[model samples]
Target: MSERDADSDDPGDDAEELAWETTGTEIDYTCPGFDVRRDDVVLPNGTETGFHYVEEPQAVVILPLTPDGEVVLIEEWRQAVGRVNRGLPAGSAEPDDDDLDAVARRELAEETGYEAGSLRQLFTIEPANGLLNSVHHFYLARDCEPTAEQDLDFNESIRVSLAEYDDLLSDVLDGEIRDGRTVTGITRYELADRWQ
Candidate 1:
């Protein structure tokens, strides 16, 4: 049964279903990181609309937890925002990356100079589902230890630090950790058992 008509037990369930039909699409712009596109879609009410959206590549974020239960975070300058932002180690998938976990591990090592003893995925999230088409794969890297010097890109400048898990959660709830993906990761880790 269609979800819109499930509660009513109506015979015309198919008629009550809401959907949008994409009649046409055009690429407005294409760049290295993302592409902007416009879709011509007809709504359930038969109204035609032009929806502009961004198609971004998939990305990954990792929270590296040390043996003492400290969470590894990165302090980096965001050129787009013109300010220093604190967040988990994260990066988009490179062309050679096999999967999201590869991207996550590479980002974690590159940004924090640590290797995870045991890495496990927490969840995948779509922080900007309305405007951007991308997924942020979140992982928990426990028992992390420094292995090598950070290998950052020329455009990247990052400082790494470890904070207590509770303290990180406090910062997240107190508006200190403002990055949306980082917030999602921390909240997911903090509330995992509760959700299960």
Candidate 2:
């Protein structure tokens, strides 16, 4: 078994230290979505090096469920990936957004035209801990109902659909659901055993 699977509990006690202290940082490039930054760092053994990473604001992914237990999924064309991505409804948190829950509510409505009767944070994850500076917060949105028309960006092409929870799970397990955040969110939500 792999190291992660081998340890059912805390593994930090036996893990090697690979921590780095950032001495300085600079933004190498910036774009509409994220910025690439270079950091001057001192390694654990006092060796200095440069580390590059992508930085972005925190984002939220909502697993919206209809009253009948169907999951709301989105198929969006992602220019970076050069194909349509199948995943949960997600978006970046706006500067003025009240909090993570508020971001989830807003993104749910804006992307899928659905409003959640009850929303709760399921978990948060860093898709790329080594190379990205962003946290993806996953929310479980229940009793969702159609509310308004999708308010999408000019570059967004999102097709929303409702799928049975089991079907969604099957897709994730069978490799049809490939989005990192989506797979992580589903795994966490199911592991919680709170599906209703």
Q: Residues 1-196, candidate 2: write the lDDT tens digits.
A: 0011224334585454655677888989998878888889899899999988888888999999999999998899988889999889999976577688888998999999999999988777768867787778889999999987799987789999999998999999999988988889888888884645
Q: How accurate is candidate 1 locally (lDDT)?
A: 0.82
In model 1, which regions exceed 4 Å deviation? 1-16, 193-196
TM-score of each: 0.84, 0.87
Query: Model 1 — TM-score against the truth?
Result: 0.84
Model 2 residue 180 CA deviation (Å) reads 1.1
Q: Can you write out model 1's per-residue Cα lDDT over 86-146, one digit (the tens) per residue? A: 9899988866677777777788898899988998888877778678777778888989999
Model 1, residue 63: what's the lDDT?
84
TM-score of candidate 2 on Cα atoms, chains taken together: 0.87
Candidate 2 residues lying further than 4 Å off, grouped into runs, are: 1-18
After TM-score superposition, the amount by which residue 68's alpha carbon in candidate 1 deviates from its true location, in angstroms, is: 1.9
